[model samples]
Target: MVTVKLLKPYYIKTDEQTVRVVLAYQYFTLLINQRVFQFIPIEEKEIRVSRENGKIENIHDRFAFQNGKTVIYMSLVELISAPNFLNHLHSIAQPYIQSEETKSVTLKEETEQIIKVLEERNLKRMIDQALDERNKVLFDQLVKLL
Candidate 1:
């Protein structure tokens, strides 16, 4: 069994259109088989939640965290289903969440983000292929896109 808990005071960084919620390390943790685990920050783990509906933009995504060099995957969907998850989210993230009147995201910004994610995914795929083929030159070129 797994359990989720939001530890306060949550860490939040906000730019113009989105809030970056830092969960790895301190703000969040996982409990499995009665043992507690601390999340390792993988991929700089920038999670974006929509200001419009309070839903994670990548709600279907699963992120990998490390436990003593062993990798564990957890889903955003599973975490949100925890008891009182919304109440906890509201309580912890309320200070940063904007009012309904001002919470709208422009289509342009959303489209741009989608494009960025797609490009990054492509770069990662190419990078992996380069490594698999032992093509250091191509790998270097792809990494520079990061």
Candidate 2:
């Protein structure tokens, strides 16, 4: 069973709108639903949900998991549809959870490795672009983190 939990919630404001984004710390295991894992949302593919009359509704008609092969996605839906969903989610998410006392530790080292790989890909792209533009200032700033 996989356990999913929100790490923290934050807001980003673009010129057009302010949006809320939630990041789950243990996101890599979610890929069991299939498809490549991505830290960033694809353009025109973000799910928008809102609270209405004390219930959450999808603001848009897009289905978040139209072609996903993972079981947790359905488990998540079941969790949202019924009152007892937390228990169901708990069962699936238990393994992925860390002790509250040791919040800094990740339950699965592999998930951390996958996150590093994804971050490395983005960093490599930025590094390449910086080199092409001859921007040593930005390249040095990025490489230090890498």
Instruction: List residue ranges in candidate 1 displaced over 4 A.
Output: 6-10, 101-146
Q: List the residue pairs that clash in candidate 2.
A: 2-92, 2-93, 3-93, 33-70
Tens-place lDDT digits, model 2, residues 1-146: 22322222233222212222332323322232334322222222222222111122333322222223422223335435444434433343333334454443443566798989999999999999999999999999999989
Candidate number achieving the greatest TM-score relative to the actual structure: 1
* TM-score of predicted structure 1: 0.53
**lDDT string, candidate 1, 95-136, tens digits:** 666776554455557888999999989889999999999999
Residue 136 of candidate 1: its Cα lDDT?
94
Residue-pair clashes per candidate, as listed? 0, 4
In order, candidate lDDTs are 0.67, 0.41
